[model samples]
Target: MRIPLYALLLCSVPFMVHAQSETDSVHHSYTLSTVNYTIAGQRYQKNYTRSRELQQSTDRLLERIPGVTMIRRGNFAMEPTLRGLSAAQINMTIDGMQLFGACTDRMDPISSYVEPNNMERIQLGFSPNGEQHNASVGGGLNFSLKQAQTGAAKVWSGLAGAGYETNASATQTIAALQYSRSRFAISANGVWRRAGNYTAGKGQEINFSQYNKWNLGLSAVYLLKPNQQLRVDYLQDEGYNIGYPALTMDVSFAKAKIGSASYIYTPTGMKLKSWESKVYYNYIDHAMDDTKRPAWQVPIHMDMPGTSQTMGLYSRAKWYYTNHFLEAQFTAYSNRLHAEMTMYPKNAAEMFMLTLPDVQRTVYGIDLKDKIYLGQDWTLSPSLTVNYVQSDIYTELGKETLSSLFTGSLDRKNLIWNAGLNAEKHINGRWTLFGQLSRGARSASAQELYAFYLFNRMDNFDYIGNKDLKQETSVNASLGMSYHQHRLHIQPQLFVYRFSNYIVGQRKQGYSTMTIGASGVKQYVNIPDALLYGGELYATYRPWDKWYIQSTNSISIGQDNAGNALPLIPPFKSINRIEYTPSKYGFYAESISQSRQDRVSTAVYGERASAGFTIFNVGAGRNFAIGKNTLNVHAAVYNILDKQYYEHLDILKLYRPGRNLALNLSLTF
Candidate 1:
């Protein structure tokens, strides 16, 4: 989800997927959102105080966008979901580099590592047609980090910030510095965060929610010539003592290091307009155990550790001639993963270790796009992508216990292609129409094909991966329109999707299983023929100066060909907002309501129905000057009425947080 913020403190704006041109003669700053922006309407930018600490996880940011939601289990690492799809169903990236999570229990989601402080902008694509990343059923997210500002004159700039929250006793500190001169610039930023257990609305103390985190980043850019540039970036993220009450274990520690370098050239007075080449490396190490949580009465001492490494290269170029624009991209990436589990019994007898064989996946892809302008009010854009993916297992336990339980070879390969076509037209200056159609495909993930007996407490099921799973393909379509004029902005969209070979976990008997919960075992398998449909509506009205009213509503339904509802589908929901803004300060009130979800899918191993809930929130912020420095102060209250409710998407349906107060302060020099 992406929001625009420049200087305004009030006015309603939607989070969006970004689309921009490659030509130097074109400049676009707005995003594609639920409520489209118009030349005659007002635009507002969003601001988050204490961005470095990220009061909650990144889920809090994505939730504000239409068609986006999160799966909350604990206070940390809330998993993001889009239109009822999550995990491997979506493409997750940072600065165009893919990063896979290392936890079988999902203690770490890709979004947990990057906070607003390190983010300059986000390019979000809700389409499942590999428009930006690769084939996916839900969508794609790309987080671009902040770069050193450039200018002709030498300059120095920096910021210092600190914040505290009352409910959880959370504290945040952050600092950043930058220097630019002529064609060269360098910048760096660091952040630290710590928190204790938080209380529910009824003052119920929740365990396993405390955590500490550290983040650091640096970047440098140099101009090679008038239209050529070189850039480098590095970031490190660390977490200690993170907790997850919904899962059986807590994360003792997790760390990630990411590095990238790119060269860009944009030429004028030529047929070719822009070209870019980039290479990157990322590594993640994660360890989890029950030692960090309250000691269980059981006698077994168990620990699990996992690691993932990724290396990739990406190249793209765009060309412009008359009314036609063309762009092409090529990429090659490889991912390696290793995991092992250890156990020690109080009786100190017959302790054993089972390690997953090494897993490696390599992918090569190419994409081409063409945009043609017809007359002045109509535009047509078409794109196509082809991918070849292969995964090979190394050190396959030859004739060992692993070979007896799982069937099929560990080597898998698939060739896939995706296509998309979009059309847009301006009926008049105040109204515009757009439509899109696409077909996309995604292959089974390595973990889905090879992980052994991973514990899942949510459904009380032990999961085993099958190497024979097939690919997933989706046919998708959507139509959207906008009414923008004067002080009102309204945008509405409708969409539908049909899938073949949908991947899901299936209950199976007579399989080696973990002796916990119901002890039921399952395998990742492919289901045929599934359908999903949905729509969203958003509107904002500004009747007077410094005041606005905004409202949004959305709903989606999913089911298999047998008419059985699918699991993890979101319910009908709406969000309403009222804001008042004046020069140095602003105030707002918000309410979110969700209808009960009764259409549960029993086809899922242990699915359950979900209840409805409503929440209220209020916030305000101000800017002031102290000596020669400028300072901004912000404060907010959540769950103002202290209502106890839970979202259906929550992994454990845990009660949501109670009434809470938060304060943030930032100083600039």
Candidate 2:
């Protein structure tokens, strides 16, 4: 693994001389084209998706990106983390649309509502480059949905596809159709997927790992005149019998509905280069129970129900000139969430408990970005954002517990802002160096603000929210260098952040008055100061004409944190691959390795330790053409070595899937 990785890195330096032009971009036609490898400002008109990638979940695909980690509670909706930050710290949206997960346990991530087949592309903006999402403190991940294209051909077009995997007995089906004419276009896509229990590397079956899901999307586009256009989109997704063995309960049913209308004006006039405005709304409902898994047991029978309603609006405008560009945006959004868990005595019919009620978070924000070119070798970019956030916990029925503790109806208001600057210099014809400095802030999540007597499995503790908690803030800086050549691209960067009023789970000293079965009670508390620092190296190369190799290694550490280490900090990890794709066919072999995660927070947070393991994977595929359609085929075996292991990121600490084979076939015109 090291040999191929080093070869791919060392032999391509000379080839990079011809690609010096990559350091500068006007159209930004090529963004991070690869699956999981991207840097700030990476922009591409057409994204690349490997054949094998189609068979993997969206969360798994995102793992390929450096500094990105996935917290795997189950097979779906893996929580994504970057640079030791996750959840609301990283703004996640679909084409500028906001969504909130209904599950307090985080069983359903926003990404779960979007299927891979419905995605046109994904762009993640890091610090100093996230003008698109000003509220983000760490980064922003944006999913661009497939839309009806204007000026389409007279004939109708459609595609159909199916896929399967063995480890979980999973199956996938997909279909899409589109029609376009002189001025209007319409498109629709549907997807269905189902899976059973997944087998581990040691042949053990993890309960609550099965799920069935489906989604449908409809879109319409009209060319108003010239470069002006209008578009509308609607999407709905449903999941049934989703299992979460790691959590206290399993999800029985969940559904999401989202709609958006946007107007885009990109006139050739050039003075007002572009203007975009959108209005979007999304809703989610989820229900969970322990009955989904017969083997699962708890002291008391419980039912969990959750729902969220969100409305948002955004508009952006860019003015361009010869050597300078300026842009500004306005955004406002509000989300209301009602999540409650009720416990029923197994023997007594009259006793039940109400947990978590009346939580809402609303935000309004604006941002600006400026880019200036210095001579022919330097570029300067700067951005700023400000937001007003409000949190409310209304106990109109007097049924909630936290309201009594806080003495009255809970209300909190905060005004926050973030600013960043990035500078880049082109060095001759082979190297480029960049630097970034930013100060960002994030408002507390709904749970952090007002959850009442919530049970947390990760630390085996009952959690209560803090109404007076301050918003978390961070000051960060990073430096990086990039080397580009004909056959290789290598980029390495190091970053550090100092957090103020960092919110963490602090173990309550006494348990006498705490909820039952609680090892300890945890309350949101402010740690005066904490620090997180990390770095990652990404490299890709083509040693020969037909062979390509890629590798990434990342590590991060947290200090002055709540535990021995930052909660869920990933260990030293690497993914190395060698592949050959000459024509319509391709073949590849890969190795994934990780170091032992001994820096556990168990002493402070009662988190458990995790052992490390390595896994081998391989795949091959080919495509064929018939009539007017093209058929693409792919097959792969995961965990070829069948090594027994589980990731530290799994909050439930469940064993990862072992050896499994998958096959995919699709056709398109």
Candidate 3:
């Protein structure tokens, strides 16, 4: 892994150097639409500082973004879907570093490893032109870590906060500290949270809806020279006794460690604007069991453990020229995953099998992007990425276990690539039109190719892997118009995806299930084709001074070649919010509603129709200053009507939380 990373780094050195040219003013223009959630500065303090967002998890914050939804199994680690696409379809990264989860059941997503307090901002891309780092169909999401601030008048700064919630009897605590010097800066932060079983609407307790977790982060930056800098970051996250009400088993423990080092160079008088290189490593360990279940409910005692490790590096450079902006990157990474299940049946020895076989995967990729300013009215941006992927089953036992079901070699390799073109026409200062077209491909994941009897609680079926599955490819296109005026802004966009060799689980007859009481057995297979289309509309208006109103609406539709609806597609959803701020105090009201979803893939995916529901929330907050210190207090009431509801994408149609009152307090100096 180290050797390959070094080789890539050496190969990227030439791209960082160019003929020197006089520096000019930088022009920041984008052809593709992007949403940036700022976590620092005045915008963050004005919006999120007055609400429960300061105390909420990263996943909770993500739910508020348009075109993004969560698949909730429990209160912790909800999986995020971008434009109705999830898992291997989208790419998620932290600070440009690739990370993979260790849980075979996807109980721990990458978002769960970072606390909101340690983040600077979140960048969301909705087009392939924006996802230049990876070949993905849905898009890309990057979580930028907060770095220590240097050159502040005050050399030291810190904050401490705490929060409480009524429905789940949950408590949260957080603290952060930073020190800055003329050329050096360092920051540290930590967060801890604990929650008990939560009650649904009508005061009905939801069993096993509890969790406990803690996260710690450290970051440092040093200036080697006026134009050179070095930065380092480390993060540690751990969770214990996390309950999942919709799944058969609960997580006993899950932990992750991530670290990265980076170097950045900015020259004063050259065409090369900046160059950045980074090396990163991460490891995760997860274990789950049914020990918390009642004896009558447990048909068999089982324990599952999984581990994943990754090491990677990337070099990126940006160059500016007359009427053109160019960017290039080289990335390489190696990842290993291993998972096993041990089942104990009555009057029999324990049966053991590899769920996610010991699999090693390596990838090398290059990306190039260029933006051209055409005649001041139109902007054209084109990008291309190519990746070489190789995967193999390492352990002989894993190979032999798959040999019983498959008849060929267990090694697989593929060359994947993505190309995209974006165009933007500025009709006027208040109106703009943008469009994107892209084609992308991705290889199958380890679980989709080599897993042994992985149980899916959603359909109550045991899933087997197929080693001969073909790569999935898609052609995507989108068009949108943005309108902005004095007090009102609205944007509406529509997108479509046509996929070939779509991968899905198909029921297999005459195959016995390894999980006790499973409905049947299913295997991963490739279908001929599939289609997915969606649209979103976002609007914001300011009626008067210190008052604002916002609305967002989204809808998605999906079908297979046979015209059968795809499973897990979300229904039409809408969110509306109103806010008022006066001096040091703020108040807000929000409404969230979803339409009924009757499109069920009953026979193939075991999906059921979901009913429509609506919910409301209100919050108020105030800020106080004393000497050099500041204090903030906030209170919110969620599900004001105590309505019982579940989203269409929720697993098992689990009921959401009931009415709850939350209080938060924070102190900064």
Candidate 4:
């Protein structure tokens, strides 16, 4: 029998590991434990505090996680997928607030609204017991915002930074300032970025790849009492002249405004450990057009505009009992979305239609969880959530648009629930084992249930939604092991999911196309069953006091009940790195590799095979101290081999950026 790579590494190295339980106290600035695992209650944090990471985009920093992959349409905004699941299958949030994208083509994901400088850390929950905020089977990702800090030694502190990249001729400038006292704290930050067209491998300039954007954030906190505080936050982001070479149209502008307020209380020497209540609102606007394309390239010109607005609130409390920890939360939200398109044919009258129509959705949910201690070395956690959802077409034009396709009521409602159980056993001080089993279900999204004549650039097909589609559900199971010795740490995890009423877009034969020079139409449909399985392995070894080596590997497999490959599934990929660090300076070398994927879903998804490739990168950094202030400089060269390649998930098979040098400098006082 052939042994797996993870198993081989497990046998060859002695490891050390650590796990978190519900009883542990939460930190003000959450940081990942030394060992990062996919088990229940596992938290992972990137080194975003470093100067190198502070200069990168939010999307680029997210790609470093183990089970995450990015779907790129351009250099600007990229959508993220967790364990091969995208779109509505996963729940994404900012500071525990619900937000949705305005673009019908998914050019503006929620992550695009927050810059890296405004973020503190990211929290991920994969197990049903871990994620009780929403009805989702794939998992949940939450971006934590940076807040003002009180009781600091200095009355004021801030950082200023600038960066440049050769490949895209991109320039970036960022600034942050904070003021703190015994009872009050306030912070403000801003970022600006501009880029020209980028060059692909072999110095081929990729046209229509330029973009410009800016972001601003402000936060304030006031201490009402020794154990009580009030906080408020606001953020604004805007983008203009954004180009997408992979698609037929480019975005003229995209903008978002978000604001929130919260109250937090911590009780000492009581069963009620902590309580928090928060309310938030957000708005998004996006517009795109094909006027940038040449006359011959675009037989007809079209304009598309979309908007989304949301308001939400949540309250959570934690309590400690004898040998048990208990928690409960209540959440409610309302959202409205509208999208429309107008096409102008040469020497003909203008035609208009509702792409997404005017749709309204409201949701309310409650969650309860408990962690029981079964002695000193074992623990069990159980969680449950109940949610009520109501959806309707709120406009006469939307009702009229969908009336031609379906002969049913325009109102939809559903009650959904999710439950999960997890267990952990610690055999010794250095060895641990964990397992989880859970089931979850989610209602269809607005786009999936009521969209009309929505064109998909990936498959070159137009799509219509089905209002009568059934809810999708999944059953999940996972197991993991961790080991830690003196200088080595290793973790391996495996997971599998069985889905019911899986949703997909099926081709409708003999149907006319809506877009110019497009393929036939496709409609959303539910299949009987589908399966997804994946695994991840992480290892780090310290050969000497100043040198460290690390390896991360992940693989995913997806198939339908009929033994057909699923669309957009990524192949085996690995990242290896070596680093040497002394007190004030550091140097690193990294390699990223992916295996060739031959599995193609040509019939339904229009997928093609992709070849494997590898790339190398190197970087170094140094910090200089002058008085009480500090200055840092970092530089790196990426894609040193200049290989022409694209990942399996890259839509339209656009080649990634080629060799480039990046430099960043920052000063803190």
User: lDDT for every model?
Assistant: 0.73, 0.74, 0.80, 0.80
| lDDT of residue 586 for candidate 1 | 69
Candidate 4, backbone clash total: 6
TM-score of 1: 0.92
What is candidate 3's lDDT per residue for 469-538, written digit by digit as tens?
9989889888877777777767788889899999999999999988778999999999999999989887
RMSD of each: 5.2, 6.6, 6.8, 6.5
Model 1's C-alpha root-mean-square deviation from the true structure amounts to 5.2
Once fitted onto the true fold, the runs of candidate 4 whose alpha carbons sit more than 4 angstroms away are: 1-49
TM-score of each: 0.92, 0.92, 0.93, 0.94
Q: Which one wins by lDDT: 2 or 3?
A: 3
- lDDT tens readout by residue for model 2, 308-331: 888888899998777788888888
Q: Report how far residue 19 has shifted in candidate 2, in Å.
A: 12
**Alpha carbon lDDT of residue 97, candidate 2?**
84
Put down candidate 4 lDDT per residue, 207-250, tens digits, no spaces.
88999999999999999997899999999999999999888899
Model 3 misplaced regions, further than 4 Å: 1-52
